[model samples]
Target chain A: MFMAGNVINIFKKELRTYFTTPIAYIVIAIFLVLTGWFFFSTFFLFGQTELRSFFTLLPIIFSFVIPAVTMRLFSEEFNIGSYEILVTLPVSLNEIVLGKFLAGTVFVAMMLVPTLSYAICVGFLGQLDWGPVVGGYLGALLLGAAFTAVGLFASSLTKNQIIAFIIGMIVCFTLTMVDKVLFFLPESMLGFFQFLGADYHFQNTAKGILDSRDIIYFLSATFIALYMASLRIQEKQ
Target chain B: MIEISDLTRYYGDLRALDHISLSIKRGEILGLLGPNGAGKTTLLRILTGYLAPTSGAVTAMGFSIDEKPLEIKKFIGYLPEEAPLYKDMLVYDYLNYVAAVRGITRERKTRRIRELTDICGLSEIMHRSIHELSKGYKQRVGLAHAMMSDPEILILDEPTSGLDPNQIVEIRDIIKVIGKEKTVILSTHILSEVEATCDRVVIINKGRIVADGSTAELKQSSELEYALNITLKGAEGQDVKTLLSPVEGIKEVRELGATNGELAFRLVCDTAKDIRDEVYGKIKQRDWILLEFTQEYKSLEKIFRELTKES
Candidate 1:
C-alpha cells in the first residue's frame, strides 16, 4: 500500500520533471510539424479525405520522438548517481518501474493531443469516417507506447543519453521495419517474424479491425520491454 | 540501536567488508575512520539499505536490513559522498519532494521544510536552482534533504569533503548540534574531526575493523611510549643519554643529533609512566642547560598505523 503511494509520488515527480523543461514542448512541436506536413502532402497529392497517409507516416515519426522523450529517463539518473538515492527510498522496484513507464506514456499521450486538430480539419473539409479515425488514434497511441517502452529499455542499458537515444532509435526502427524484411523468408517463418513487427499490429488497428491478437502483441511488447528495463536497473545496483 | 553481525560485502570476488561486527547505541555519535578504499562507504551503504551485503545481517532499530528494508529505510537518512542532487530542481521544491517521498504529512511538510532550511542555513537559497549553488550549498541541501524526515539514524559519508574551510567548520558545528538527538554515523579520513566530533571511533583498514574505541581509549590502548626531544647545552651526547637512562620508568634513550652547541636526544618511556620530572631533575642536578624540552603525545594517526600493521 505504501509502495503504491510512492509510485504515485514518483509518477507525479517524473511528470513534473518532464514538463518543467522545454523537452516536452520541443517534442510536441516537432511531432505536430512533421505530422501536419504529411497530412497536407497527402491531401494535395492524393485528394483523399482518409487518415491513411497520416497513419502510415506516424510509425516513422514516432521512431524518432519516442526515443527523444525516453532517452533521459534512466540514463540521467545513472549519470548523476541519483539512482542510489532513489533505490534507498522506501519504495519497491515495481513502483519505480511503473512510475517511469507511466510518465513516458503520459508524455506520449500529451504529444497526441495536438494531432487531434488534424482529425478535426479533415472532418470539416471532407467526408471522413469516424470509426477508422478512432481506431487510427488508438493504434497510434499503442504504437507510440510500444516504442516508448523500447526506448525506456534502451535508456536503462547505458548512462549516456546520446547512446541511449541512438540505441532506442535503432531498436524502434528495426522493430518497425521487421515485416518488410520478413517477406523473403518462407511462409512458415514469416508469420513468426510478422508478430515481432510493431507496424504489423498497428496496421491492423488502423484499418478498423480490433483484433485481440494485435492488442495482445502491443501490450506484451510494452510489458516485456518495461520488465527488461526494471531488471537492468536492478542489475546496475 | 544498530547491531551489525558479521556483515560482509564483496564486489565480485574482491572483498570490500570482511565480517565486520559492531553495535552502536542509540543517540551515539560514531565516527568511521579509514583511508581511501577502506570499506567505509560500503559499510554505510549496507547499513542504509542502499546495497545488500554479501553475507551476514544488519538489524537497525530492531528491523533486519535484508528482511524489512523499507522499515529500516524509514528510520534512516543517508547522505552519500557526492551529495546526490537533481541540479534542475529548486532548493525548496527539491526538499518538498524529498519530504513527500519520505511520507511526511501534507500538513507538516511545509513546516518541516522550513525548519530544516533554517537549521541547514538554506533559507537564503531556497528559491534558487541547485545547479546555480556552490558546492557548500549543494552539500547543505543534501543534508537538509536527509534530515527532512527526522530519521533516527543518520549516515553521512564524507560530509565535509569538497567544502571550503568556513563551510567545513559550519557543517561540523551543525553535525555536533544534531548529534545530540540522533544516532549520527559519519565517515571521514580526517583524524582531528573525529577526535573533535565523534564520541566513539571505529577504525577500519583493508576491509576490516582494526581498532574500535573512544578517541582517548584508542590512543591509550596503542601502548606505544611517547618520545621527548630534548636539546641540551654543555652536555655531551653520552652524558645526556646516561643521565636520562637512569631515570625511573625510562625505557630507552638515544641521541638523535647535535647542532650549534645543542644536543638532541629522544627519550622513550612506558606510556603509563611520567619520566619527564625525573629527567628534568637529573639534568638540573648536573648543571646542564636545558635548551629545549618537548614531549610528543601519542596521536591517533600513529595508533591507527600501529593497529593496522601486521602482527
Candidate 2:
C-alpha cells in the first residue's frame, strides 16, 4: 500500500510539472489542430457516418505526439542532475518509472479527450455505430499507453531531449508502420511481421472486434517498454 | 550511527574510492576534508545508498546498505554538490513534493514544511519559482528538501562551496544548529570550515584515508613545533639570538629583521617542553625594552597540507 502511494506521489508531481510549464498547452493545441484538420479534410470525402478515418489516423498522429509528450520525463531530469535527488529519495525505481509512465499515458488521454467531439459531430450527421466508437476509444487508450511507454524508454536512453524525442518518434513510427512493410518480407514471415505491428491490433479493436489477443499484445508491449526503461534507469546508477 | 568497512568503488578502470573504513557516532559533526577528486562525494554517495560500492559494505542505523537501501535512505538526508534542483518548480511545491515522497502524512506535511521554511529562512520566496532564486537561496531550498523528513543523518557535499562570505557564515550557523541533534557529515576543501563546524575531521587524499581525528587531535598528532616571535627596542639582533639560544627548550633563535634600531627574533620551540617561562626569565636579565611577544602553534591549515600533500 505504501509502495502504491509513493507511485501516486511521483505521478502527481509529474502531472503538476507537465501543467506548470507551457509545454503541455502548446503540445495539446498543436495535437488538436493537426488531428482536427486531417480528420475533417477526409470526413466528407469518405461520406461515412462512422468515425473510421479518425481511428485510422490515430496511430500515425500518436507516433509523433506521444514522443513529444514523454520526451522530457527522464531526459530533463538527467540533463539537470535532478535524477540523483529523485533516485536517492525513499521511493524505488519501479515507483518512479511506473509513475512517470502513467503520467505520460494520462497526458495522451487528455489530448484524446478533445477529439471526442469528432465522434459526437459524426453521430449528429447520421446513424453512428456506438460499438466501434467505444472500442476505438478503448483501443486508443491502450495504444497511447504503449506508445508512451516506448517514448519513455527512448527518453531514458539519453540526456538530450531532442534526441529522446527523435528516438521515441522513430520507434513509435516503426511500430505503426511495421505491418505496412510486410510485402518486402518472405511469405513465411508475413504473419509474424503483421503480429508485431501496433496498428494491426489497434485496428481490430477499432473495428469492435474486442479480441483478447489484441488487448494482450498492447498490454505486453506497454509492460515490456516500461521494463526496458526501468532497466536502463538502473544502469545509470 | 553508521559504519563503512573497506568500501571500494571504481568507474570503469578508474578507482574513485580505495578501501576505506569509518565509523561515525550519533550526533557527531564529522568533516570530510579533501581536495577535489579525492572521493569524498563518492564515499558519501555509497553511504546514502545512491551508488553501490564495488566491494565491502555500509551499515547505517542497524540496516545493511545492500540488503535494505530504502531503509537506510529513509534515515539519511543528502544534498549533492551544487544542490541541483528542478529549476522550474516553486520552492513550496518542491518541498511539498519531497515531503510526500518521504512519506510525511498530509496532516503533518504542512506543519513540517512550515517548520523547514522557517529553519531555512525560505519564508519570503516560498511562492516564487526555484529558477529565479539566487544560488544561496537555491541551496537553502535544497537544504529544506533534504531535511523534509527530519532524518537521523544528514550528508552534505560542499554545502557552502560558492557562497559569499556572509552567506557562508549563515549556512555554517545553520549547519551548527542542525549538528547539535543529528549526525552531520559535511565535505569541503576549505580548512576554516572544518575548524569552525566539525567536531572530528577526516582528511582524504587520492581515495585513501590520510588522517582522522578531532581538529585539535589532528593538529597535536602532527609534528609538534611552534614559533615564538619577540621584538626588542635596545638589543642588537646578534645579542638577542646569543642570549636566547642558551635557554632550555629553545631550539633556535634567529633574528628576523631590524628596523629603526629595534630588533625581532623568532624562537622555534619544541612543544614537549614549556620554553615561554624560561625565555621570559632570560629576557628579564637584559636591559632591552620588550616590544612584542607572541606564540603561534602550527595551524590546522599547515597540518592539512602536510597530510594531503602529494608524495
Give lDDT tens digits, candidate 2, residues A185-231: 99999999899999999999999989999999999999999999999
- Report how far residue B272 has shifted in candidate 1, in Å: 2.9
- Candidate 2 chain B TM? 0.96
Candidate DockQ scores, in order = 0.67, 0.86
In terms of DockQ, the best-performing candidate is 2
Residue B207 error for model 1, in Å? 1.4
Model 2's CAPRI class is high
The candidate that wins on TM-score is 2
Question: What are the Cα lDDT values of the candidates?
Answer: 0.88, 0.92
Error of 1 at A172 (Å): 1.9
